[model samples]
Target: MSQTVFCRKYQQELEALPFPPLPGEKGQEIQRTVSKQAWEEWQAQQTRLINEKHLNLLDPQTREYLMEQMERFFDNRETDQAEGYVPPSR
Candidate 1:
């Protein structure tokens, strides 16, 4: 039941799976599963940093800016999901 043992047992099986992994987990998830402790620690640190540092800079305008940039990136996934195009991309 320990993580390392599980990884050694199932890593190939997981990697050879036919379907795509979840979106955020597309590539790194196998390693993440294999290295659960490191992954959790890294995620915790990243969450702490993002929540404490970058998130503090956010405001209504900051939200708008993020919406703008994300909409523009990769051909406007945001606007399509928005039920309509939105904010006119700035």
Candidate 2:
């Protein structure tokens, strides 16, 4: 059976991740608060940010930027977007 958590992003109980997505306190907080679905969504967005912005994750600055974006993402705060990105029409 899958675990469930009170997802801070979704504002309700939902399926939980088996482990934290990152290391240290932020990862622990995500484990306790973020849902699996939300994390997956962030992964997709992160990928877009990487590809569109040509972010080199190997660089410390890029990694730090992504970390901050990840925090804002889970907290439902406004996050930076890839330059020239256009949302697909529904």
Candidate 3:
């Protein structure tokens, strides 16, 4: 059976990740409080942020920005978006 957690984003008990997405306290907190679905959502948002903003992963500033966004994302708070980005039409 999959591990379960009281997902902070969803406000319910749900399946949890098998391991933390990062090291240290933040990752531990995510493992304890974030759901698999929420994590997936963050992944999608992270991708969008990276692509839209043209972020360079090797840059420490970009990584720091992403980490801050990740925190806000899991906390159910608004995160910064790539300026002037428009969603592609379906």
Candidate 4:
């Protein structure tokens, strides 16, 4: 089940306590919160891991195209290193 569902269920149980918590009860809630947080953390980490490991493999033409795009971007940019010519905004 989703973390929200788990939290809601456990929260209901905590609220149904006989009286004030016995000090450590709050720790249980904190642990559940950490676990839910870790689940999301690990999920994002897994996505990054998958992309880094497998999904981002670049073929030759793709790499060439990316390089061409970068070159084009920098080509249109001006710097003091250029022939002192200012770029006109189109």
Best by TM-score: 2
TM-score per candidate, chains pooled: 0.30, 0.87, 0.85, 0.25
Per-residue accuracy of model 4 over 21-78 as CA lDDT, tens digit each:
2247653543443334333433454444345444343577644543343333323432
Q: What residue runs in model 4 are displaced by over 4 Å at the alpha carbon?
A: 1-34, 55-90
Name the TM-score of candidate 4.
0.25
TM-score: the better of candidates 2 and 4: 2
Q: For candidate 4, what is the lDDT?
A: 0.37
Residue by residue across 15-85, what tens digits does model 3's lDDT show? 99999988999898889999999999899889989998889999999999999999899888998876786
lDDT for every model?
Answer: 0.38, 0.92, 0.91, 0.37
Off by over 4 Å in 1: 2-34, 56-90
For all the candidates, what are their Cα RMSDs to the real structure? 14.4, 1.6, 2.5, 20.3
Ranked candidates (TM-score, high to low): 2, 3, 1, 4
* TM-score between candidate 1 and the true structure: 0.30
Candidate 1: clashing pairs of residues: none
Please, what are the lDDT tens digits per residue for candidate 1 over residues 21-89?
235563345344433433343345434434544554347865465435332332313321222223345
Strongest candidate by lDDT = 2
Give me the overall lDDT of model 1: 0.38
Give, for candidate 1, the lowest lDDT window spanning 10 residues: 76-85
